[model samples]
Target: MITAAPHTTPGVLDGIVVADFSRVLAGPYATMMLADMGATVIKVESPTGDDTRAWQPPVREDMATYFLSVNRNKHAIALDLRDDDDLDTAHKLLAKADVFIENWKPGGLAKFGMDPEAVAERYPELVHASITGFGTTGGAHLPGYDLLAQAASGLMDITGEPESSGQKAGVAIFDVVTGLHATVGILGALQERQRSGKGQHIAVNLMSSALSGLVNQTSAYVAGGVVPTRMGNDHPSLAPYGPFAAADQPLILGVGNDRQFRQLTTALGASELADDERYATNPARNAHRDELRATLETYLQHRPASEWVEEFRELGIPCSEVFSIAQGVEFADEIGLAPVQLTGAEKVPTVKHPIDYSRSQVAYDKAPPTLNEDRQSILEWLDAEEG
Candidate 1:
């Protein structure tokens, strides 16, 4: 993706306007991607503000960090859809926009006069991108939240220690996944519009995206007839392929084949164990993985995880020290991921949008707005449009 450098901008979607009706993580994440791609995003928030605005004590400039994480690079406009004037203004904005994004319940928008088909009917070429708890089809009745989706789709069932009750992933994996799928749908619909000169209704939901993301595990069940189970830090099928405790800390390693396993054993100077039938080939090793893990841990516990990482990397094994969120950001910078964008230096340590387009950018990074911050100015603009 093109960098949102002030001096040089590709502006692929420069003329396009996106009327953002979504809030919170998934919707905002999708719009942020769109804004970064150069669309003008006007965030239409409810009057009390996005619920996330006051989400926590970890505030930046006294504003919630939860709010800051996603609502960047867009103009904020608060609207009470129940009020006729505000609803009229919203309709006006939608009529002129190239895209409309929302995260309401299946029939929520229809009640508000903003359903996808209605918007498409009014603006045939508008890309109506929606993210929700579930799709409008079979799972429509279910609520859409990351944890709930995880639990509903069986992801939580395979996430924790087998002996313990399954746990949700540490992060809102399903919400973020839905956001990404939303973006994909929007972009694809936009491309189709280029060809047919008419946009289509596109949607994604946490529940659907969560199920889609369980590709490997689901494929195993459907194709191989195996009900996958929680194995804690261990791989679903590959044994001795998860986190191991070194002398100082836990480190993860991906031993792909017998050859790599041999290399790992040699690194530990325990090659003799590989020849033993109990730990010989991959399958045999997997079958007796507990025994192999015990033997490996005995040797690994003699060295620091950091030291093990260095040597394991050199052995062409995929391994790394598990990092906390902060450490992950630091490591990303060290390896050129540059995941953090230091706009205004340390004052705004924002996460960069993942996609980088050579010929275009999403939106420029802008701070989140205060409640009703854009109300006066937005009303003025709408008044001017009417005149």
Candidate 2:
């Protein structure tokens, strides 16, 4: 729920035009968020289409799910940046755009004269968001992808089940996170543009976001002289704070301190265990976690995960039954957490804006666009601009 602050909408970025020259996840996701906040995003695709357009499996309506998942409420236009005519058209849009986002390989866009530096020099008022695999700095030449970044940042070294050798997350978390950072950078630059009447160059990369996301673990490793280990399903400092097998399914429980620990034990009909010397304190319980786990399992085996969740919740312990993906979505909906959505006007797939603004409404009211769907209208506008 991190939101752009101090700016109430008419939409914070209202009336801004974003020339999106990015393909795939990170860049599209950033502009998607901007579009949700009232920016006009015109997505430019090559003749073969964005790479994700062909990535498939859960295909629907002849469109790539990968493409649909991130892109919506956008106007897509086919362009060939290497072609003089196409490059001319892009520059035409750039002249009037307030933001430009691109994720070409380092120097890839430069070869086509779409480099941020070159464009910025020409249009100092346009905010430039450059998304890259590796940052354009020390490791600029190295390739970057979400999984690669997870490994490079050492997150994969501590992510999965210990037996599984800490793997990359199933989802491309780094890419998504990097996109969010890029969005934030764009918004910040937009705000700064208000004061200076000129835009600044903003860049976001997967490596930086992945590293930034390793917050607590990174701090402990850097300052406490400890290399983090794969804890698997357990919290490093909390006792009995991971998954436990119940009769029907696994449940996750968090007994923060002695008080909650006592309540949890009571709920499980093992009151005396709470008073036991080795289980009486958080540290002690953590030290004897296996023993405590065995005790909890012996009791939990008598009830389903849902029952246990209810019992622990009633007793004031932080606990929940592990849910399947569908169940999680249903639960989010049931509790007023909107997850899926359709953008108005275009009937496009859009997830709910993550931020809940009390004063300013999100800008999205339409679905993501199809490839080159708005080419006619966009070109018409660009054509009319010369007049």
Candidate 3:
């Protein structure tokens, strides 16, 4: 575990409070980001705890790493909302909170009187953000898992090789993307609230976030009248932009434009290739990608990937030898990015939040809590507020 420089300054979001009733990935991830920015996030779980508490096997001590990954810098209290006392506690928490977030199924929280409509009516000054698998309209009944969103949103359709079946991303990408979208929406609403002195409902769903996150791929079909298909690692538009065989291992080349192409060919001692009409311009190079790949490999075959990576980088060509996750972390550290932080009393290792600010710092003062670990303190605080 790597330790980052300690931040002594107050957080940018020091006074903001968030009531987080989200379980699993999307909602918790968003709340975690808020917590990192110094929001006092209270994670309200069910009596059984968050679902990720049981998603173990990759464990640190008795805790699930998956749960730990996104629950730090927050206090936790498990509340059985079915009971009147616990439901009242939840309501109290919301009364003091600036933001409320949940990922319950559409109408799932209505029975508890915690749905968006009810919350909006009750606490008009509190920003309420909802994350769902699908929208609350026609697709509300569909389960909101990342895999299902990937399948439904054309991500799976365009992933993998031309002949093989589509593959889900190694991680729950849509869930993370949806969380980021929720975070942005919540922040935007909070800013708007400063002006209007009233908060609004912010809704984000996995399927919509997935389609938007697809960016250029979806733009092709929607704007350019082209439906893209699977091409393995190769880009649909950019040529000479995928992994190529070096003498020992594969090297990824991201030669995006004519200049990079020229730099790449010249570095390989194949300067004449830059003059070839079929491989000169981006459009022409994309049209002759296969031939260009074959010709590039003929020159690349003389050197190992590592050697080519060094030379191409010096020549201002975008290239890299593939790295495993471990190596990736090491590389980040090597470049002076302290990628991990040992947080809280137990010194649990956590991947640090990726942003850097000049005035305020990201918080890593608390570790992810055990189930309902903060119940006594939270309850005392709530009772004291009532008193």
Candidate 4:
């Protein structure tokens, strides 16, 4: 288990207020980042609460871990936008908020008068961010689900083995990446607001984010006119850059350049392989990857993966034995990454923010809230809001 950092640092967004009309992953993750940075985030849920509230089985204190994962450091309140009184409450919250975020289907909130365009018009100084499955162009009507976005954006198509069916990532990776994009957009808008004295609408969709997140995979198609297929553990352009079998377990290698490849071969007691014309350069090594893998595995299979990992790491080659999630957390802890943070009075295990700020570290005191847990307090605050 990862150890927690001392949760006493103040957030950079200390005075910023966020009206979080988002549920599930993308929007909530973005708002959670803001909340951790000291924004007072008021999560405005529907009368039934966020959909992930019922995503259980992996529950703590009878609360869904799914909900807990991305909803921390924020207040929760239920509101029925269909009702005039609750709608008024939402309006009040948004009016006083510095940032507003939602993931309703494109144009879904137009009826509620809180769509991106409407919000931008009504609150010209408020940062409005909208997350959708697709943009408001030809595909706006489609719902935004991670799996659908992955398949539609060609991420799943390039994911697993070339011979096997497409596979969705282990996690809702596109959703998380989209969330990061939304957060960056919001922050950029906030910074620009200082110069323009006005806010702007920040739009992000899973499909767009997924396509962009594919990075080199999509680039190979768009830039090089090469439609990349799934290579499983094999990298399309790199040799000795995937997992090989050891005596006990699988070991991953990342020989980024010819220099690293040389270092790897030298460490493996196969320095002669580096001098071979077919394995000399990266492109040549990639062209002869099958033969190289067979040769490398012959030496790798002589020892346990753990032994190779240590020796290869010492030789400045990137390598590791495949680790389970639990092992991953333990390894991070051992390396002083402090991957988990204990938050709230109950001290729940939450992932720490990955970035390390020199002046201001992330704050993680408050836990994820229960449904409508702060309704009375939030309403009181909104009731006291000035024009």
Candidate 5:
């Protein structure tokens, strides 16, 4: 099991060192983002490796795709943190790290002497980011999982049809979003550390991230007292903003404003529909959504979704044909988004980091690591003095 950092590009986070003690989705995803940007991330796994290592049925090269998706660009080692010698190694890594991340249960790291207060006291300049299922208080005892966060955050309740059972999203969306949040928080803290000359504790939890990620749905309740329910694919506040049937399949029409609505109507060869008093404004369109949908379907039914997608797009109306994950990737490639890249020994497929920095770009230097593969190198590095 070899882990080699590719030498093709420069990274923005080139000098930063991260001591990663996270497993599963949220924490690993965040650290991976850091690694992509040039942080030297040491992923400290347990004796058996991260739990996602066994999450199979979707294995590539006998490796769980789940684990592969988020663990790239890092050096990995397995250690029994409970052992005195192994715990000392972890402490040595932390002493040199500019950032430290973990997703263990609240209070779980205290027994190993890695608690927030202790770490801060030991290494005052180390930025410590903690990911939990819940925060460190009332909900601390409850284990965090993506499904539980979705349920507790009211996301599931507003996901499906009003009459149907609440449905979780097709992916672990909240966990992913939480991971992004954690990345943002870590970066911000690092920026501030430049001036403060001290590190701070950053905490992110699945439930809170779910609520924040809900955005408009949560806003309707908190700001307007509206307890929004599932409208299926239809948006709660916008009309002609969901999937609509075509001659052969469903195409999504996202008329964000009256101008887009007019374009859509003109593209459908039904310009008069856009001028109707009942559908002139966004508010009016929402009020008359059912009628508007029916009128659009009449025109959309004349062509397949692909044809309509082209015509509507040419007219500057926001529209697209529904696609599977593979198709979505193909479309991205077709449009020059370059959504994926191959890295490391197996030439594994990895999704590109979402942002494109012109001057200091993200680098796909290392592929996802194998268990204890970099143990000797990382231990030797950590044992050295400050540059």
Candidate 6:
């Protein structure tokens, strides 16, 4: 139910066109980022619409908010690729597109002659980006769901308390990570095409992105031969680095090094604790984390979390009171981030893209469209281009 803004500015990716055949979270999220940067992304869905369109209950004007979250600033069209005419229309769109993105199974699009190999051969200049739950090899048969990725990638193994069952992230983290990887791959391929005058395939799978996104945790296993386990909110290596009770509520302390530990102890009126051999160095403090926590809480118990947050911030200590989603957004706005914007005539609020550029601005011209709302105009544009 979001619509186009009346006035707009040209974006950095103004000339690029994206043929977005991606559905659901990962693929659509990537194309949305592209659209935010000013690419003309044509989202081609099935005749029914993208699957997320039906993921409702949390609805906005009867449209799925989940769908709206990643479909903004793009035109949409419904086409049944199973039908010959609709398949031909897709081909025509690809012919004029700078990038083609999809998340179908390995051979899913082969019947329609839209497989990566076929698309690459037919549109030699177009970047073909593929997202899958797993890679097209051994794991292709498996579905590419975020929870599965979290479970398979050792993420769930290291998450939550040791005593509790493994838990998936609050959000679809791997999906978002995979989308980011796809966007990077597409942009890199586009850059390479500038010199070679040809595009290449960019394959990103959720499992692969999950491993990479795990970063230090994966490194602990692969590089150090240490299989990390769940420790709840506590960091495996960094002591005094998790949430601690602060009179009224919990405050997270991210004291990473000896210097920060010293600063924290000083701020808490417990400078003597930092001087103790058992809590002086990071490794030493980690060894006695329980004792350190017990000691710190004695001093922290006098002040509320908010007061501690302010005092610790002024002292350059990395500490914060845990915030709900609404509070997080409000904090961002209060700090002059201007994180939200109203879109379309309905004035729907959407998050602004996180990045800022000196020479070019991110576009927020169009809102998430109604199903197949731009089909006629898109087809007319295609005809004009073909002519």
Model 5 TM-score? 0.97
Model 1 error, position 216 (Å)? 1.1
RMSD after CA superposition, every candidate:
3.0, 3.8, 2.9, 3.3, 1.8, 2.0
lDDT of model number 3: 0.91
Q: Write the per-residue lDDT of candidate 3 for residues 1-387, one digit (tens) a residue.
A: 111122356677777889999999999999989988888889999989999999997999989999999999888899999999999999999998899999999999999989988999999999999999989999999999999999999999898989988988989999999999999999999999999999999999999999999999999999999999999999998989999999999999998899999999889998999999999999999899899999999999999999999988888899998999899899899889999989888899999897898989898888999999889988887777678
Candidate 2 scores a C-alpha RMSD against the true structure in Å of: 3.8
Alpha carbon lDDT at 197, candidate 6: 99
Q: Encode model 6's per-residue lDDT on 32-132: one tens digit a residue.
A: 89888888899999999999999998998898989988988889899999888898899999999999999999899998888988888899999999999
Give every collision pair in model 6. Answer: 133-144
| Predicted structure 2, TM vs. truth | 0.92
Q: TM-score of every model?
A: 0.91, 0.92, 0.97, 0.97, 0.97, 0.97
**In angstroms, what RMSD does candidate 1 have relative to the true structure?**
3.0
Count of residue pairs whose backbone atoms collide, per candidate: 12, 7, 1, 0, 1, 1
Q: How far off is residue 66 in model 5, in Å?
A: 0.6
Flag regions of model 5 displaced more than 4 Å. 1-8
Q: Which candidate's lDDT is highest?
A: 3
Residue 1 error for model 1, in Å? 24
Q: Candidate 6 local accuracy as lDDT?
A: 0.90
Worst 10 residues of 5 by lDDT: 1-10
lDDT of 4 by residue, 293-365 (tens): 9999999989999999999888899998898999999999999999999988879889997777889868777
Pairs of colliding residues, candidate 4: none
Rank all candidate structures by their lDDT, best first, as comma-separated numbers. Answer: 3, 6, 5, 4, 2, 1
Question: Each model's C-alpha lDDT?
Answer: 0.81, 0.82, 0.91, 0.89, 0.89, 0.90
Better of 2 and 4 by lDDT: 4
What range of 10 consecutive residues in model 2 has the weakest lDDT sum? Answer: 1-10
